[model samples]
Target chain A: MRNSFYTAGFSEVMHEVKQDPREASYIYTTTACNSPHRGLSAAIGPALFGTVKSVRALGVQLADSTGGDPDGPSPMDLALTGIASCGVTTLLGGGSARELIFDGIEMLIEYGAPDGEPGQAVRCRLSVDGVTDEPLMNELVEQMQTYSPNMATMIRPVPISFDCLVGTDESTRRQLTVEAEPITDRRPAACRVRWVSGTQLVSYPNGRRMLRVDQPKQLTGVDWGPNPQEYLLMGLAADVADQLGRVAYRLTGERHLWEVSTSACEDMRGLLLKERDVVFLQGVTCRVVVPETLRAETGVEKILTAALAQSEVRDLVSRSNPGGVSLVLGREG
Target chain B: MELNGRTAIGFEEGRSSSAKWFDDLTRVRFAGPVSAHHRLLPRELSPETLAVHAGTYEDPVTGCVGTPVFQTSTFLLDDASYSAFADGAMRDVPIYTRYGNPSQWAVQEKLAALEGSRSAIVTSSGMSATASTIFALTNAGSHIISAYDVYGGTYNLLREDMPSTGREVSFVDPNDLAAVRAAVRPETQLLFFETLTNPLLKAPPIGALAEIAREANALLVVDNTFLTPVNMRPIAHGADIVVHSATKYLAGHSDLTAGAVVGRRKFLDRIWAQTLRFGGTLEPLSCFLLERGMKTLALRVERQNANATEIARFLATHDRVAAVHHPEVGGPHYADLARDDYRGFGGVVSFEVRGGDDAALAFMGRLKIPYVATSLGGVESLVSMPSNTSHSSLTSGQRASIGIRPGLVRFSVGIENVRDLIDDLNDALNGE
Candidate 1:
């Protein structure tokens, strides 16, 4: 009377969902912030930490290129991990729906680089055990491509926009708006993979720092870590700082000390309003302080402009890159 | 992929591999009952029809009308079953009898159908059902409000056992809606009350208490054992969960000890998990007995209701009987609520003899037809004194405060010919 996914409890939920589709609708929220204290580094370094709240709060940490933490993963690392994990989860769910029995599955995701390098395709190879039917495995992999949320997010460009408040000094400020064009033609990004069963992470990279995210106190959040917006601002500040360090190093023989502070204006009304014509944040503001010692450098103005221009997270926030998915299979041990 | 009970074929031999990969195969998921018979009966089906047919598992191979007793500990594992375990949804897949069995599924469907609930779980005993429901719904620091006069086992669980585990219980008079409301705390997570109180048969206003529970954002768990689903369906009156000592009426012949919990699947799933942890799973044989016994539930209860009503009337008019307590005899504080809410006033009746404990004992000793025993709700009449039986643990002062007077005799009417029962009662009263 019971199947893999069509459980008794699930049937009840299905019945309720059938009565009201809204019962199945859910909105997921994650909050994040930068690490409280920056580690000692000669160059610009920042660690972004956040919590992913669902039934339980999970801490996620994203280390920038210059500020990598031994326990923390970089943004590319987390994103790739998410893609891989989500792929396995989606595959298992879809296979169960179709009544396919699989003893085990090992997926390998190969991508060109952590950064979205042009002309490199995302490829996936799955090693399956207990089932020899290649066609069914291919069908399941196809379903995984269609059903996985992270896969779909990568395969199609997500709309992104940014409003920024920039200041070279404490007293002066200016606002700028940047909206990235949506990609009409999509090329798939290389895939990432993981193994999962139940709620446990069966196979994962060892010894990574976890970023914790939670709701605000009003929403029963423990205030243990930052909310999602704080995480975005945190990452942005670090990325800009890293870029500034690079630009300064390129111009001068030594790394210069600099401080970057970031904030965003969030509208509660926008969150409460209808989906259309509503914006969660009015804009994000980043203020950069150039050391008095470096202020006298001839190329200081150009370095500041170039740092903001070359920041990877800045480009990520201001643009769209739709990724794609591919699949391969092998024998399981 | 054999259908019989066994561990997975290929994965069983590996203990040296990653434990995480093989953990799903080792652990059993309590997915609640999965049965095709569930919800097959229409909402409008009469109790009589539901009792007989709602949960009957039909064998596809033999076309057997009855549920086959799946008397095994575990089930064979295949791809579909492995998928079930991997997804944490081993329900109805029969991974282990403790997690689920066709026999348990059959009875659970019947109970759910009878109670008009989304699902039901069968436990080893009534206390198991009650305990699991309480522990599952409330957290460590949570508060519970229950009747002071609840079943001795439940009262003991709350009063004696629960406090050690950090749950505070406040015993309130179920009739006092205002007191019940006042007892609610921000931490209160559940309100536990019996539909009809044991020994006294006091009828709590279920609808009003349900209202209080809602306002307090607490779950209303009613023990519907006395009324069963035949006399009253507590869920219809807004009870969030209903527990029953199926050892009594539901399994009317008293051949098996079992408990049932009926509620929304969400709550029942949590309770089912707790039951598994508590190790209160009924074995396959007992499940079979309980299922077979429940088939005639409506028929047995219909007769007990009528028989008890007549005995209550007879006791009310007797000179030797100081008082008679039955909902039909207008003894409960909320007689009007009982009249309006219940289809039948149930089978138990209690009365106080004129001369207190000694006289009551002598009269019970003189009875010919009924057995002088502890439990109730059988085909044969059974009688007991609360002072010596159910309430013996309570202090004299505690007993007096709750109106458990010295001579109170609890009578569980059976489905016997009323004329003979009345004659025996008359003879016992005469001290012959």
Candidate 2:
């Protein structure tokens, strides 16, 4: 396989496949290898960008679709996405180790929306099939639930805020600006702004007069490991990068510029559709900003091709298994 | 306008104004008020004053109003025959601090008086008090009956550790009297329960359990860590022995940890024997701090109890909260039991979050004021998930069977302003 891999050409081997978001579909398979395997294993179509893949061999899928915003997650949105991914990943790992093959799998997640929000409120769902033995199926479901990364993050929310400074560089005097803003704005970066007393030279966005205090301070980085969702994302990104690097290196002669970004989405169609318990992934989309030259040489039509082949998340997401949701209500009137 | 109880000289008021009469009359004054006379006044003083003033004797040398912390290890013999007193000839003699100290006795006497216990024994920690009481009450091969949902440490001690020592425990639901009665065996020597079970917040029927214990010829030990005597006096509810994890509401400030076993002299003497043998006595400094803490126990608990009640109400109304397991709002039996056994609903409330473990964890993470930590009854609110933190050792099946759910949260309401606590909870629950 190593010798044959060098001869494979990008255009000659496979054509770039276009994914349609309207059609909801998934692939399922199980293979047992003796310690090592050559082929990268799975694929998640482009339509499901932020969808979560739950459980490995018995591919379980989770639906989530809040992808465009760069701001912090809304209410339980991040938590829902985290659990979906975590559950999918854990199940896949556990099932593959146990040789629990699946014909199909699915997951549906739904959460109450913020009051008076327009459009479809957030709901997430995934489905999978083709596995025998109800006991094993239940065990896989329970395991996924127990280890769901997104679920863990949802349970343990973290305090996250950022500050943005708007100023240009100068040799002697660079006018620095600070803006204290809500964390919910979907921005990639923000600056913290505050005013110093007894000085009237500068003013902050919040109307506080900013004065020359001391040198500008960098914003503190958030401690993200304690959150299950962030940790799971970190795990997924690292795992994909590791596997892709090996395959990419084997396919090509040298290491190249490769960046992997994963976004999880939950279906909010129920809120929009006025239906109960209806949810599915908007998509699980990973944007791999690989060099165009590497893509042309390695016959990698889609950057996610190698990622899907080796990513456990991809395997779990492609299965789309079925699971149950239990809700409890308060007793007080 | 007449002073009904007054004696008056009528007509002579205007005519008897004479300088000679007034000058000849001698004025008699009574001597200073006697100390004994103050003690004779019937319930004239408040308990706040009584705790600090009653039974207190000013230092003979320094005349300090506050009791001093006596740190000496030994006391001097007043006479040459002190050795005779040590040889068991003299009855009331303190040779060593380990045996007893005046400072320890002062606090002990004060607590005993306040709790209305015939005798009291203070120990190093709440667990020590419980362990000592249990050890003193039960022997090898003796069987003990206890509530199923108890403090994790106590549960382990009774379930695993006690059995290793040839003692067996039969954990029964205190709410089920029949189950409790059925679990009792010929060797059963003692019955143990918390007035309110930790985390679970189940208020057991102390009086009913006590009656059962009395009939069975077993000593009843109640851990009154949650509902302090200010809110619920276990002894008053027929409990034979009352134990407190003074680390909770008793300390109020969360600075010191101590324990006490309050009961009849016979039982307490047995505990004292165990204490001396095992040496789990509380330090003088801890005892002093505990004494100081007791001064505000009533006030602190009143505020905490009110705060918890309000928080429970808030949680009960929350959409994210599935069920509030607080005894105050549970089954009729719990309400009746709480009413009969406790003067007020305690400060600990357990509730289940809607989305199971995931939602529970998220809520805990989002809390701004209440800390996500273990242990309860502090001045600051605390929240914990029993499944993952305290009772994580138990199997999932075991946890579920005992009603500890994946989303269950045990809250220890502190003395923070109730509005602040409610607002924090509202934000967390509403996902604001």
Best by lDDT: 1
The C-alpha stretches of model 1 lying farther than 4 A from their native spots are A1-333, B1-32, B37-39
How do the residues B1-432 of candidate 1 rate in per-residue lDDT, one tens digit apiece? 345422222222211122211111222222235544333576468899999988777776687778888899987767656655654455546778888888888889889989988688999999999999988776555688999989999999999878887689999999998899999985677899999999888999999999999877678999999999999998999999999999999998868899999997667877887899999999999988998888989999999999999999999999999999887778447545647688897789999988999999999999999999988888889999999999999999999888888889999999999999999998998897
Tell me the lDDT of model 1 at B243.
99
Total residue pair clashes for candidate 1:
23
* Residue B39 lDDT in candidate 2: 18
Per-candidate Cα lDDT values, in order, are 0.65, 0.51
- In the range B245-295, model 2's lDDT, one tens digit per residue, is 888877767788778888765457557657767787777777677777777
Distance (Å) between predicted and true CA of B200, model 2?
A: 1.6
Error of 1 at A39 (Å): 27
Model 2, docking class: incorrect
Worst 10-residue stretch by lDDT in candidate 1 chain A?
A44-53
Q: What is each model's TM-score for chain A? A: 0.54, 0.30
Q: Which window of ten consecutive residues has the lowest lDDT sum in model 2 chain B?
A: B28-37
Q: Which candidate number would show the highest DockQ if scored against the true structure?
A: 1
State residue A183's C-alpha deviation in candidate 2, in Å.
99
